[model samples]
Target chain A: MPVITQRLRVTARLTELARVRQFVHGCALREGLPERETFACELAADEAFVNIVVHAYGGESDGPVFVRCRGVANGLLISFVDEGMAWDPTPPSAPPWESTETEITVGGLGRLIIHRAMDGVRFTRRGNRNILSMCKFRPGFSPAE
Target chain B: MEVKITEYKRVAVVQPVGRVDSNTSAEFEAELRRLVESGRTNLVLDLSKIDFLSSAGLRVIVSTMKSTRKNGGNVCVAAANARAAEVMKLAGLDSVIDMHPSREAAVASF
Candidate 1:
């Protein structure tokens, strides 16, 4: 199948997450990805976009977050680009699972979701732009090992 | 997100509809906190209608759970859709929060 690509640019704000998610879902549907895989891709993209909007700009400047989705080879590739702060993209460790003795706090769940939902993830920095790329392979279409 | 609060077997059941992402999680959190402050300690969040659940939503759940636990109560989850369940499992929330296949089971767990 021919690859289809779609791109969107929005301000680095939390309110823009819904728009981004819609774009991803549209592309996923167009690509004929299964419902479960589409949801996984959407979740991974949401995590990456949220991270960029909340942590990248650092409350100093408002910038645009660019998103690109490509459907190719029975998979989806979603990339997020932002011209905010430059930081490493290492996935954070998940918080302790047992909530018996301590109060559950909020942290590290985004990275965990991103890493777990997407089959492949990569981060790159180039010329003041931070790029996060995630890929989800369709079920029953895995490449030969 | 639209939140509906009802009582089930003495447990406060909070059901949120629509997406619970960064854009809408604050509202969801506020409702949960209000319920906690109203002395409704036990919570069972019905996620069947929620189409999306992001980290922001997870943060609200964790905070609410903590507040309720401090009051000698707890929060449980019920009827999470596939996407919500996947995100919760990825975050290892299944271990931290009690999740039930249905509202009855969640209310019973509490």
Candidate 2:
């Protein structure tokens, strides 16, 4: 089937997380994605949206987060666009599971989860906008393999 | 999100109902940390009631799992409805954390 895409605009607030998840899930369902893939897509979308809501707009006020859900020829494509701070989430580092005895506190692990869940992830800065596109390939339903 | 804590056999079970999103994510993290700092490391999070989960929530789970694991204890998940379980699974956390079908099952695993 050809690619089908859906678009939405969400505010930079945490409350919108549910709405965003719901929107993505709805689109995935309409695109005939399997139950497992649908859930994964929702979560991956949630992570991307949360990053925009929390880090974008300097964490001060609300802004716009543009979301797109599409069924690509190979898999699914979800794009999150925002005019917030540009940050690259892809890094060659694993999550810190190191044993720390002297009490330790660390954050910034959400990006790691996002990077590992989706099949493809990219960050692009165009003018004043930050666009993040993520792709998830259907398991055991590969046309290329 | 609504967070409810229940104690069963010396373990504190946190049941966070509803969606764990941006606005309520911090509150969930705070509650989990409070329990961990107070030495209530034997935690079983009942996610069956949670309809939705975001990365913010996943981060809290990962961090808590690390903290409790380091302290010779661990946080488990009891009864995550399909959706919540899928979120945990997608993040590759299903292998990292202990997940069971019921609170009793989770406690038994510990």
Candidate 3:
């Protein structure tokens, strides 16, 4: 099967979250990922994109953000590159999902879920840029149908 | 996501339709809190209309579920499609909350 790869440029705004999701899902579909895997792809994309909008830009404002998806020999690789102030999401930490009501606050839970849903997630500080990547294997076929 | 609240007797069932993402979760947050503040603790979310759910939406549901439980009430989800159901299961919410195949079953769980 031919590998599928694509890139999407989006404004660093929360509204573009859907656009990002569409792009990722489109890539996954071409890669023959299942519906469940497609959902996982969308969820991972949502969390990473939201982190960019909310934290990378400090919710203040930022320039264009680039989301690139490339199908490799084994799976899909999604990279999010932003020009916002550099921050690494490598050291993941968040309150437990089963924590008490007070600890179950809505804050920082997005990243946690992303970590759980994706096979591999990494954050890098390239100069003054923040680059986040998430990878998941192509489970059989069609990530989004 | 689009949220519509329907009143069943004294209970309020919040239905969030479409994919719940960062852009759409605020609407859910507002509507869910509104139902709770209005003393509609006996709540059920009709996920039948929801085709997809993101972590942001899950966060809202989990938080509300915790709050509802603390208030001596409950929040259940009904008729979640495959996409929504998979995420709920991955998040382990399927175990904590009552998930039904239909709204009637979810409402009856209260």
Candidate 4:
């Protein structure tokens, strides 16, 4: 298969999440990914994008968040770039799903979902930009060299 | 996202059609919070029409659940699609929140 690449730049705002999902979904379909894998890819990308829009910019910055999607080999690679604050690699662990306590707690689930749904996640800060790259590989398929 | 609220045996069945992500979760939370504030503590969220679920959406659900339980009521999810179910499971929400296979069962639980 041929390599496919797409890029989108949107304001780091909560309202722009739909556009992000649309962009990712289009890319996933173009890559011919399975339904399950496409959903996983979109979820992972959504989590990462939300983190950037909500946390990276503190919901105040008017900077732009750049997203890039690439279809390579038998997998999809998605990256988010932002000029907002760098994310702390040490995210708080997600609470167990089956806690015996009656009270339910919120937070940290985004990181958990992203890490679990995607095959690989990498975060790095270069100069003033924070780059988060996530990958989703099809089952029983390896990326072509 | 389109949210449809129906009452069954005093249980508020909140159905959100479409993706519940950051873009639409504010409205989703607002609608649910309104129900909770109106003394409607029992809620059954029908997830059958929800094609996508994100942490932002989960936050709203968790907050509502906490609020409802404080008033001797609880929230249950019913008929979530496979993608939604997988997301809920990965977040461990499936355990924290009661999930039923059907709306009738979910409403009955509350």
Q: What is the DockQ of each candidate?
A: 0.62, 0.43, 0.52, 0.52
Considering only chain A, what is the TM-score of each predicted structure? Answer: 0.87, 0.85, 0.82, 0.85
Residue A86 lDDT (model 2): 84
lDDT of candidate 3 over B3-80, digit per residue (tens)? 888898756788888878777878888899888887778888888788778777888887788777788888888888
* lDDT for residue B98 in candidate 4, whole number 0-100: 89
Which structure is stronger by lDDT: 1 or 2?
A: 1
lDDT of 3: 0.79
| Predicted structure with the largest TM-score when compared to the true one | 1
> What TM-score fits each model?
0.91, 0.81, 0.87, 0.89
Query: Sort by TM-score, best first: what order?
Result: 1, 4, 3, 2
lDDT of 4 by residue, A1-145 (tens): 5666799999887677778988998899888898988888888888888788767887736799999999987588999999998875444565544444433343367877888888888999999999998898878865563
**What tens digits encode model 2's per-residue C-alpha lDDT throughout A5-108?**
78998778766777888898898777777887777788778778766766666563467899998886567889999989886666437544453432322224
**Alpha-carbon runs more than 4 Å astray in model 1:** A59-61, A96-107
State which docking tier applies to candidate 1: medium
Q: Per-residue alpha-carbon lDDT of model 2 for B1-110, expressed as tens digits?
A: 79999877668999999988666778998998999899888999999899778666776787788788778889999999988886676556788788999988988777
TM-score on 0 to 1 scale for chain A of candidate 4? 0.85
Mark the regions of model 2 whose C-alpha exceeds 4 Å error after superposition: A1-4, A99-108, B33-39, B66-73
Once fitted onto the true fold, the runs of candidate 3 whose alpha carbons sit more than 4 angstroms away are: A1-4, A88-95, A98-107, A140-145
What is candidate 4's CA lDDT for residue B32? 94
Task: Output the better candidate (3/4) by lDDT.
Answer: 4
DockQ for candidate 1: 0.62
lDDT of 2 at A71: 81
